[model samples]
Target: MSVDFGQIRRNEHLPARIAAQIGSDIQEGRLKPGDKLPTEHFLAKSLGVSRSVVREAIAQLRNEGLVETRQGVGAFVTERQSRTIRIDEGELFKRDSFRDLFQLRIPLEIEAAGLAAVHYKEADLERIDEALARMTGSEKWTDEGIDADLAFHRAIAEATGNDYFALFIGFIAERISLAIAAARARVELEEIVNVTIDEHVVVRNAIASRNPKAAREAMRAHLLGAASRVDLTLETY
Candidate 1:
């Protein structure tokens, strides 16, 4: 059962284009969770791109939480949206909507941060680092950077070694992207970008040091900071 990927058009961002096509396949249910992806070699040949391009595209998909790769096994579609709450776009634009999303996330993600600090494997740390690098290097308010920011949080969720944590956070993050993008659009301050980078660094460093308490606090503070920047408040939950 080989996947017949269409040939890619010539583009400056080949990997992104390839990733979009594969992501579309997953979204459309042409690919389902646990379904194995075509081998990099096969995808490269069929798509008329280098293996490196395919590899990068796969990495991008992984960051987007649309796919996962095993140590010796190949890539597979991730479990996403199987039990997701449907978010309404009109509600997502409401002034308080982002805060509502964060309120639900804070407890779960705080626990996830602590658990990740205690349970994270070396590869999990590497994935987190890679996502952080992408966010830090990206242009402020760009979709690519926002994707990386979301990826950073999803990596933390995965590091908890709980599949449900990853699955839930991945689904939630996808929905919240609409709000984050809208919030970013209204910002006039460039300092927001630098602050975000520093905040992520704090969380990353705490997790890397294996300090569960510090990781939890850092994660909470970061999320709180994000809410503050967006003019949202976190009430007692």
Candidate 2:
């Protein structure tokens, strides 16, 4: 079968863009389940990208359960009728897209924090504390520190006793972390890092106190502060 793959523009996150485009094809029924994807060499040539980018894009589709690869054969669309939610990384760089994502994040995370406050076990608390400690101990401007920050939030999501919550928070947090890292790049890194740590501490303290309302409010404040740090203006409600 002939596939009309578009040539990719040179930009950051090339692989993700390719994956998003192919994923769109799958979701829209243009690429049926069991339809084999073009070879890496062909995709690379068609898209005007390197074979490595094509490989990574295929890897992404596999991770999202939209595609399955057979050894030495090729990649084909998965038989699953539904595709998992995916945020196009390229869109995250756009102002409106970032704002929309952050807006969605507010209610979801606020609720997650409240639920965590109500349901968190001692072990959950320890995980949260461990992540916090790692963030505090790591270099302020390093990827390790950012990862620790994500872990801290993930721990709270896990504490909610909801696997879906954990899954979504993990996905959204990963994408937002990219935006956060970019924002941090343009400012006083040390200052932003310190403020972020302080905000996390407030959220953690509220959860630890087992006050759902307080935890919710703390999370709201922290998320709002995060958006502001990124120079994005979001409605406060």
Candidate 3:
């Protein structure tokens, strides 16, 4: 039976709602394992939601281990009982997802920052600097600023001289993008924007100076500040 996307109403929780419907489809075998889901654009149009909403819904499924995404191809249901690992809804942007996402980043990124201090190349420094410049020059709390923020962290991950580190951080960043967007919406924008830039500058400077310990500490401090801004308590996570 064809899914009637038109019946889905628009609401604040649209992405979660969409994810639930698709999840129900998967569970019922209407969308069997290995079946390719509709294109993001098609799903967006059909559901009367933006492409980002569709993307987020798909990302949610991916986190749940209910779906797999192949580059240049669409998402497909994961083979039944094949998921060895899965992130539940609480680990997403729902209640404490941001906290969980930040916790996931702490160890990995702290290590990356240290490695970047030890191993970063001139080109890596340039990319990081460029991202920082973009953040400093862009409007506070805008989507562009958020992109630049993610880019700065990604540059540090790349500087680790490990393909796996960059790849892993990139994956985590994609999953957390919506969480970051939501966090950005809840705070005093202008204040947080300037503060975030300053925090980044500290991290960048430590990396530039080739101080591994300092870089690690700076990165830790930066992330802690971010968590505080979002009202996410990371101590327990």
Candidate 4:
């Protein structure tokens, strides 16, 4: 039997419940990155809700940056949260069962990126763009490049309507910075830096279109790719 969390209704909160379901799936490893979710009709049927409700729920998850839906490919798990990421001296060291952390973070970042695409106030965009510009301007390496990179992510988190996301992401900033450093060092790809700006642009465009699914997908790709770098670097460790 399929599971559902669709009882949340008027005088209720379907979106939150839906978010919880998706979030739980990631945490439990029931869903992996790039794994497609049940279709709207299937989800609606499983959850005992109208297709509109399912879509709304999916949009909420997309807004949270957890799942991405293709135009006709249904919804896929773009990213998942990690359980632990203790960064020290610019390295992303993983703790036990670290999968949980990514599981938690994916949805949040995706939502932030998506919202940034839409609600990213001009000032916020300018702030991020400035950070990007600074990153590009630096031909020489400065440890502070990490700060610029993080600032860009913070901008996306801030763009989300939910203040909690910004707060949560801020709490994890130190470790995330370390992770970024480690990943960048491993990939050694300048495009990672350059593409950040481009990927952000893709995410921004999706949100601007109010295409939550698209926004989530873009965010997911960026993050999962980040995770892949971690995998690559781990080989040397």
Clashes of 1: 0
Backbone clash pairs in model 3 (N, Cα, C under 3 Å; residues 3+ apart or in different chains), count: 0
User: What is the overall TM-score of model 4 with all chains considered together?
Assistant: 0.52
Query: What would the per-residue lDDT of candidate 2 be over residues 59-136, giving only the tens digit for each residue?
Result: 567657789889999998988665576666656666677679888888889999999999999999999999899888
Lowest lDDT 10-mer window, candidate 4? 1-10
TM-score attained by model 1: 0.65
Which regions of candidate 1 are displaced past 4 Å? 1-84, 95-98, 139-141
lDDT of each: 0.74, 0.79, 0.75, 0.59
* Tens digits of lDDT, candidate 1, 1-237: 111111111212456558768888988999999999999999999999878668767865775677888988899998986323435434544556645776888888889999999999999999999989987774444656666777788899999999888867776665555445544555653666778889999999999999999999999998787766656668754
Which stretches of candidate 4 lie above 4 Å from their native place? 1-92, 189-191, 195-197, 205-211, 232-237
Error of 1 at 131 (Å): 0.7
TM values, all candidates: 0.65, 0.69, 0.64, 0.52
Colliding residue pairs in candidate 1: none
| Number of the predicted model whose lDDT against the real structure is largest | 2
Ordering by lDDT: 2, 3, 1, 4
- What are the candidates' C-alpha RMSDs? 9.0, 8.7, 7.8, 18.0
